[model samples]
Target: MIEKDIDVLVGERLAYLRNKKGYTMRKVAEALSIDPSYISRIEKGHIPSIKILQSFAELYEVKLSDLLESGDGVSSIKIEVEYEWFEFVETMK
Candidate 1:
């Protein structure tokens, strides 16, 4: 996967887990030793450094892959297949 894919997936997963744990952005930021605004930007997929992603994953107690795959636990190459189709469709239309 590309850097953008990692950023988007991790950001969305961070936001999801943070909300699931009933924590505010401020609270999560404090726990992660990062700025609240940085956390917000990450959740918005603005693409921060790799060090930041590792930090976030550690704080959330989730594996890096956990954030990448479907939250529903189903694992397959379907996501990639869909993305290829999306790219094809967008290019065609």
Candidate 2:
């Protein structure tokens, strides 16, 4: 179903944002005052309610649109890998 795909995409975005911010699931859970397992479930493609999604957007400091988008107009792994490598290089300095 379309809704299921959207959930998976949103979940992927959630996981990506959490990782990009260097936050553990426990940290996010604590910030949201939610069980860590719930965060894990959301990251595993479970469709959370709109309220929960709004909370995640706030916690991650991102627009809800960003969480729902297909990734900045690009979906290529090559681009993502190169970008991540560049980010890693920056952290090394």
- Judged by lDDT, which candidate is best? 2
The estimated TM-scores of all candidates read: 0.63, 0.71
Candidate 1, residues 3-91, lDDT tens digits: the string is 34645665777788888778899998888787899888988877665456556667777755455556563232223335664454345
**Model 1, stretches more than 4 Å misplaced?**
1-6, 73-93
Residue-wise lDDT of candidate 2 within 1-93, one digit each (tens)? 124465667787888889888999999999989999999999998978666887888988876656655566322221122465345434533
Candidate 1 residue 85 C-alpha distance from true site, Å: 21
Best by TM-score: 2
Q: In lDDT terms, how accurate is model 1?
A: 0.65
Q: Lowest-lDDT window of 10 residues in candidate 1? A: 73-82
RMSD of each: 9.9, 11.3
